[model samples]
Target: MKRFIKSRGGMTGFVLLAFLILIGLAGPLLVPFRDAGRHWHDIEYWQDSPAAVPPVWVRGPWNAGKLARSGRLQGKDPVLFESEGGGGRAVWRFMLSKEAKPMRLDLILVIGGEGKRPVLVSSVGDDGAETEVARRLFEVSVGQPARLALSLDGARALTVTEYLLPGETARDSPSIVLVGQVSGLLGTDVSKRDIFTGIVLGLRWALLLGVAVSFLTVMTGIVLGISAACWGGWVDTALNRIYEFFALMPILPFLIVLSAVYKPSLWAFAGLALLFFWTKAFKPVYSMALQIREEGYIEAGKSIGAGKMRRAFVYVLPALLPYGFAVMALSVPGIIMYEAGISMLGLGDGTVVTWGQMLHDALVQGAVINRLWWWILPPGLMIALTGITFALLGRGFERVWSPDRGSRPTGAGPSRSGT
Candidate 1:
């Protein structure tokens, strides 16, 4: 243990892994927001009252008469969306040209008034879908930079920026939506419940499944490998060849075939990974058993009238424990990575939440395109860290057990000294 901590790489990997696991475990409780899916249900909180309606002929203080000849401004567009961060926000980009051909840009805005709702139109190109900008009243103003509420489709909403005058507000404004009684918006308690909760819950499920699967596979493999190794000759040869054949077989084609036949459940993927890699420890165990079997104590046990089973197990099995554990520690990372790869390819169980699945969603659901950083980064880091932990544990064990490096287990010298 001291050696493990003293090793820089091992310590670093262990710390990173621990931090990631803790975040995955506790993140749900700390989430500040609610379900991103829950929306609609309450609208009154963000609605505008009727009295503050805007009068016609309003224009920006700078371009009051710019559009006067064409028509008088009837009303300003309701703050369609306030930036999520706060203040006026702009998602759609439009350049105001300084060229002689165009003078000043006058925005014809329609805002929602008390009793009257305006139709939202997203600007073409670069900006998101044209959406209804919500305001407290039907009003028009040219010079002031005020908050705009976005009336998103159904119950969802977003806020962006609309600037008529350059100096009135900076190019960056807070995009805020009128969080009303909507289930997922700020006004709705449901909307504000907590996003991290769900994510943490998801991570919990993932870790549970991952650990359970890995433990089962390794334990089973250890038992089978030990059995094959201790009982050499025909028994060992047959088992060794079988394991070797499986190890050599191409797994991709088989994975594709199986995934095509049925939905990839967590157990199914775990089973597949075990099928491919369980035998990895077979060769190591077989070698250990052969060495231990040639030990004087093993022969001595037989000479002392111990039963065949007792001699094989009592003398040889205990000697293999340290080596078996070391192999297991090494294999754990590979198993986890295999599961993650399968999930990333969209062959994971629908019910299980894994880092790979998260990344798959990021890709398939266009989280990248939407720039949803939270959706993709956390899960990825979790998977990576889990793998690192097992790898570090394996390396540490190796350093403590290597014949050329660390001391051998007591009594192992004579029993395993010959072979």
Candidate 2:
């Protein structure tokens, strides 16, 4: 542990990995869009946000001070006025600066009771000029809340612009949820989904997938490799053949084809990865087992009537554990990349949010062409950072366990030695 921390690369990787894990654990609680994973693809859920907006922190001369910040009026803030017709009307008023008029405005109306309810949404400017943005009679059912989302985009854009001039205070009936040109921590995607929340939620899935797959693959290899060494001749030869076949197999293309055919879920991808990746740890573990078999302790154990299974498990497996830990760490990055690659090709589970899926969305949505940097960059950077973190930790483990540079595990030495 001390040695690993002393190595600069290892320490850096540890810190980075720790930070990512922290985000994976704590991000959902911190982010405002707690339901982002569930409603990421739901257009109605994200209708309150401006589409393809940059982050709130982004500001420069290139944008010409036209970027408007988002604001919301909800709950008890909107004043409700009871009409003579046994219905109530609510109004929310907010000021828009002359320097930046909101690119988009949304009114969310939640109401209950049966029959059709007439929802009138209007934009009133300082000059008392009023423009009806939306007039819809929505069907409502008792015990079920009906929500109406009225937006300034599309047909109402011209009406809003002509009626609500810049620098004027505007009033919206029902409630005004102003979605501006700049929004959230990492802005909005083409679908207007909060990018930061999506990224944060994705971190948990990525880590879970990578760690689970790597551990399974390495453990499978260790068991098989040790078994082959314990019972040599036919057993060893057969396992060798199997390992060779898998090692030479074109995994990526095979996975792509399989994914295309089956449309497997994330867990299914992990299972498939394990089938191919076990071969990675096999050769090294087999060689190590062979060396450990020739050691004096093994000969002594055999002489004492200790069975092959007992000796293999009790003696050999323990010695290989440190090496296995290193191999497991190294294998994680590959597994993550494999999953990400499959996801990037649009073969991933659409129901779930992942870094690769984000990239795939960006490609399909023409984010690059539209110059939506926030959408493309965050997920890509996360994948790269995760890869680097595991790679560095793997190298550090190697340095600490290498035969030439590092000490061997206690009790692994020749049994004849007194020390």
Candidate 3:
């Protein structure tokens, strides 16, 4: 651990990994998101919110950035969507822009005089469907942003009656004001799924996969490799054959088939990933274990009546610890890549929320085409950064493990005395 921190490469990897782990542990508790896995229920909170709301901090003050509803405006107020006379029916068509998203429609009109008992507020969709947005008879403040929940449900127009009240005068109908949502620091996707929340939840899945698959493959491979090496002859031949066979296995296709056949699960995909790379640790571990097996320590253990299990595990395994650590660290990036690749391909479980799926949505939704780089870049950058962490760690561990290299692990003594 001291050596790891001292080395620049190792330190770089360790910091990157540690920060991601912290987020994985604490992100869920901090973010305000109802569902990270599926976003269908998110509509209840946002109710047809405008899609792709940019992060506020970066949206400099302009016509685009203005969302205030406090004081009266000099010219026509955009938020106050429509206003006209009262007495007859009037249809205010809000033509949907190409960049339009799910939006909750809101109506706010100040009735000057007295009006009829009933005034209707309805949202009309492009398909000519009518859904009631609101129905009110109460008086509204002369000017204010009402704190009321409304749903446009993808409507393209809002139609209201221009009804006149008694006490004298002209038609004074309700004016429309569309209150768009400015989500969190990161805003939302087309589906109104919060991107920040997705990133937060994804930290857990990514870390779980990177660590689990790394440890599982190295430990399993080392055990099998040492067994083959220590107990040679038929055992060595058979293990080598098995390793070679599995090494040649068409891993991706097999996983794709299984994903189709069974339900997609994180653990299940992890298991398949284990199969794909477990053999990677075997050959190197076997070579080193064989050298250690012929050492004086092995003879000493054997003369003292240490059983094969005790000899291999208690006496021999310690010599291979450095190799194990290096293999584990290096193998992590591949495992994460494999899991994310399959997921991005839509072979992963639909219910799981992963970075790969986030990227997949970006691609499918033409986020790149629309220049919504935020939707696509984050997940890709994370994947690359994670791979870099493992790569650096692997290099550092490799240097420490080499016989003639820097500080070595315990039991990695010189060939003469240590043997």
Candidate 4:
């Protein structure tokens, strides 16, 4: 571990990977919407949020343009005035702060009653100009709730724009609820889903897929390679043939076809990835196993009646473990990329929130054409950083385990004096 951190690349990779892991573990807790991961694709859940807005931090200290922030004013605190025939007027005066220069606004009114009521929603500006934003006849059952959504972006865009001017205050009457313009740490997507939440949730999936696939593949490879080398003859020939077949297979095309046909879940896709990935470390492990088998220790074990399985498991496996760790670390980036590529093509599991799925959505929704950099850049940068993290860690492991490091192979037995 000390040696691994001594290298600048390895230290940087460790810090980066640790930061990513920390986000995966702790980010969701810090986010305002804890259930964003579950409701990411549910448009209704995100209905109150602004669509396709940049992050709040973009405003910076300069206070660039008038950026709208999401806010809601419920009817619970309305000032009521009694009128004739039991019909009354409820007014909600919400101050639009000098900082909240909204580009657009939405008013949602929830009315619960037995008969139709003529509701007039108006906005009051600092100049005492009262503009009627929306007027509607809200009909509701005795207990049932009816929702009316009125966008100030339509014909009233000019009226609302004046009210939202910087350094001015505005008020909405009759319990008008304003929803969305810009919100959240990373802002909202076209669907109004929080991008930061999606990215944070995606970290776990990325790490899981990368680590799980790499571990399974490398372990399988090491076991099979050792078995083939130790048992030799028919076992060696058959295993090598299988390894070669998988090694030469066009995995991407095959995965695409299979995924298109089956539409498998993330775990299923991981299993599919493992089928080909296991071959990556096979040749190297096989060569090393062959060398270990030829070592004098193996002859000593055999003379002492040590079985083939015992020798392979108790002796050979340990020596190859360092190499296995190096290969596993190296293999993670490729596995992650493979999953991301499939996901970007829309062949990945749809139910999960992943970096690749985010990219795919960005592509389909024309994020680039619309210049929604927040949507595309975060996931892309994360994928790149993750790849770099594992690559550097793998290099560090390679440095430690390389034969040129002058460390004796563990399978060579202890020192002569100790022996």
Per-model TM-score, in order, reads 0.57, 0.81, 0.71, 0.82
lDDT of 3: 0.68
The residue-by-residue lDDT of candidate 2 on 252-297, one tens digit each, is: 9999999999966997898889899999999988988887887788
lDDT of 3 at 254: 90
Which candidate comes out best when scored by lDDT? 2
Score candidate 1 by TM-score against the native: 0.57
Q: Give the TM-score ranking, best first.
A: 4, 2, 3, 1
The predictions' CA RMSDs to the true structure, in order, are: 14.8, 6.2, 10.3, 6.3
lDDT (0 to 1) per candidate = 0.51, 0.77, 0.68, 0.76
lDDT of 2: 0.77
Cα lDDT tens digits for candidate 4, 1-419:
66676778777877888988888889768777798777778887777677898887786555543555665655445555554544455555555444334344565656554555556666655455678866677666764556777765322222211112233232232333455556777877899888888888888899988998999999999999999999899999999999989999999999999989996579888888889999988998998888788677777898899999988988899989988888988898898888888999999988889999999999999999999999999998888889999988888877667736565455757533345
Task: Point out the higher-scoring one by TM-score: 2 or 4.
Answer: 4
lDDT of 1 by residue, 209-301 (tens): 556665665656656666776666787788878887888888877886797689888777777877776676667666666666667777777
Model 1 steric clash total: 40
Quote model 3's TM-score.
0.71
Model 3: per-residue Cα lDDT over 262-330, one tens digit each: 988988988887787888999888887887877776777778998888878887788788778888888
